[model samples]
Target: MWLNGLNLMDLLVKKLFSYPGRDFKSGRDTFAPFCKLDAKLNHPHSAYRTIHIGGTNGKGSVATKVAASLMREGHRVGLYTSPHIFDFRERIQINGQLISHEAVHRHLSHIFEEDTESLSFFSLLTAMAFLYFREERVDWAVIEVGLGGLYDATNVICPSACAITSIGWDHMEVLGNTLEEIARNKGAIAKSGVPFVAGPSAAPFFPQAIHVQRHNPYDLENQEIARAVLSTIGVHNPKGLKEKPPCRFEWRGDVLFDTAHNPEGFLRLLEALEYHFPGQKFYFAVAFSKGKDFQSCLDLIRPHAQGIFALRGDHEKLVKPEELNLPIEETLPEVRPLVVCGSFYIMNLKPKKGRETLGDWESDDGILSIQKRGE
Candidate 1:
C-alpha cells in the first residue's frame, strides 16, 4: 500500500470524491471555484496549445482520434477524457500512454495541498492533467469537456481549435431542455477567430464552425469531424484516424461494448449495428446513470434485442437491476453477439482468465462485481 500502509493514489481518489461537488451529478453553483483554483495553480493549462472539444455524444471518439492523428504527425500530444472504464488513469494520456500512477500521485498531491475545498472532482483532475501536460511539455493537448461547455472546468483554455461532435438529449437538467440550448452550451467552447469544426446537427449553433457533412455509421461522422478538426491544426492527412476511444462499439470476443447512455447515442449505435450485422437480433446487457432518461434508452433497445439483462454498476449514480424492472441474470447467457450498452460502467464485467468464459456476475457490498483474470 505505502511506506506506512497509506496508498497515495487511493488517498487522492478518496479525497477528491469527498468534495461537495465531486461531479456534474452533484450540481455546481458556478464555475468560479474551478477558475479560482486554476489561477492559484498559476494556470497550467495556459502553458500549452489545446484543442477543446465539447458535445453530448461522439466527443470522446473525436477527441481520441484527433489526439491519435496528432501523435501520428510526430507531435507530443496529451489527451484528457472522462469516465474511465477500468482505470482512472485512462482519462489522462500522452501519446496513447496512460499517465503513470506515480505521476498522478505527484501532481494531485500537490494540487490537494492548495485551497481546493470548493473545487469539484472534474476540476481537480483537469488541473492535474493541465499541470502534467505543461511539465511534460507536450506539443498539443486534446481536452474533452466533461459536460456542457460554458461552465465546464475544461473551458478555461482558449484552444487552438474547438469542436462540437454532436448535440443530443443528455444532461438536459444541467444544460437545458431544448436542442438549441444544449447546442449553445456545447458551442461555447468556440473562441473568436479560432478554427472550429462541427457535425451538421450542431453546426447551426456555432456561426464560425466549418460544418462537416453527416455520415452514416456514426463512427464515420466522428472520423470526419476529427479530420476537419485536425486540418485546423495544420494536419492535412494524419494516420490512425480509425482508432476509437475506449468502450465505443468496442468488441471483446462476441460481446459488443458501447457507452451509449442516452437515447440519441443508442440510436446511432443501433443503426451502426444494423449496418454491420443486418437482420441479426442480439442479446443486451444495460444500465444507466441516475440523471439519464433510462426509459427512452430502454425503449430504443427493446425492439432490436433478442433478450435483455438489466445490470447494475459500482458507481453511486448507476441504476440497480431491480430498479430497471427487467430480468436480472447472475451469469450471462451463453449467447453470441451480446450487445452491452447504456453506460460505461458495464465494462467492469469481464471474462475470467485461463477459462476465458463469461460466468458468475455477482453483487457484493454494492459493487456489481464481476470476477476478472487473476482476481
Candidate 2:
C-alpha cells in the first residue's frame, strides 16, 4: 500500500518517529500519554496476563525463554521485544511468528487516528503490541522493557511477574552511573503483589524478589532466570527455551554473530567463547555505537581474538571503525571460525550469501532498509 508517494510502512515509520529521542518533550509526565491512550483503548494490556522483563542485558533472551516456557504449558503466548534487527514486526510476535504486515498496518492505522503526537516511537509500538495481543486472544504476553524500567513506556502494564536479567553499565547516561542506581531504576517494575525475579548479578539490588544464583556458563544463568520466573507463575517443570534469540551468540556456519555492545555483555560473551572453544583463538569483526564503552569491549576481545577487523556501517550512531586505530575491513575474514560482535547495526556488514536463514523465525526483509532509515 502507498500513502502520498510513500510505502505504507514508510509512512507509518515517519509518523511514529516524528517524536524523536527516548524522552518526551514534556518530561514532567513521562508515561501519562501512554496511560491515557491505553485507557481509551479500554486497557488492552489488561486483556491478557503479562510478564514484564527488564535489564541492561539478557532481558530479551529471558523474555523469549519465558514466552517459550509458557507455550510449553499449552498457552498462546505473545513476545514483544525491541531494536529489531530486520523488520519492525520482529519486535512483536505470537508463538514465535512475527506479526503480519496487515496486523501492524491495521493496529497502527487505528492508533494514528488518536492524538499520539506525545508518544515516543517505543511507546507507540508498545501500544500497538497490546492491541494486537488482545485481539489475537493471547493467553500471556511477555513484555520486554525498551529502556530503564520506572518511566519506560512499557511500565504502564501491571504484570503477573516481573524479572530483570542483569544489571550492567550500559545506558548509564539515562539509567544511572552506578550499578545500584541502574538496578533500582530497572527494578521499579515490581508491583506490590506481583512476583519479581532477578538474576544473580541483580539480586542484591532487590532483596525482596526471588534471586537466581549464578551459573557457570553465561547462557545457563539466563536460562535459570527464565525458569525461576516461570515457576513463580505456576508453570513448574515447563520445557525450557529450545533455541536462543536471534543475534545472541548465534552462529551461521563457522561465523558467530552476537550483539554484545556493552562492557558487561562483552565480558560474558568472551567468557562463554572461552568456555565453549578452549584453546581456540577466533578472528573478530567488531563495530559499536558512539555512546558505548567500546574500548572496554575491545580490551576484553583482544586476548581471545587471533585477528581483529574493525568494521563501519552506514548507521549514524556507529563509530567509525578506523577511529579505533585498528585494521578496518570491507569484508569479513574467511577463517575457520570468525566472531562478529558489537552493535546491532554491524549485522549490516554481514554478507547475505552463505548466511543461515532464520527459517520462519524472522521476517524476510533485509537489514539495509531499516538501517537506511536510521532505525
lDDT scores of the candidates, listed in order: 0.81, 0.81
User: Which parts of model 2 have CA positions greater than 4 angstroms off?
Assistant: 1-10, 24-29, 352-375
lDDT of 1: 0.81
TM-score per candidate: 0.90, 0.90
Alpha carbon deviation, residue 243, candidate 2 (Å): 2.6
What lDDT score goes with residue 177 in model 2? 85
For the record, the alpha-carbon RMSD of candidate 2 to the native fold, in angstroms, is 4.8
User: Which pairs clash in the backbone of model 2?
Assistant: none
Show the colliding residue pairs in model 1. Answer: none
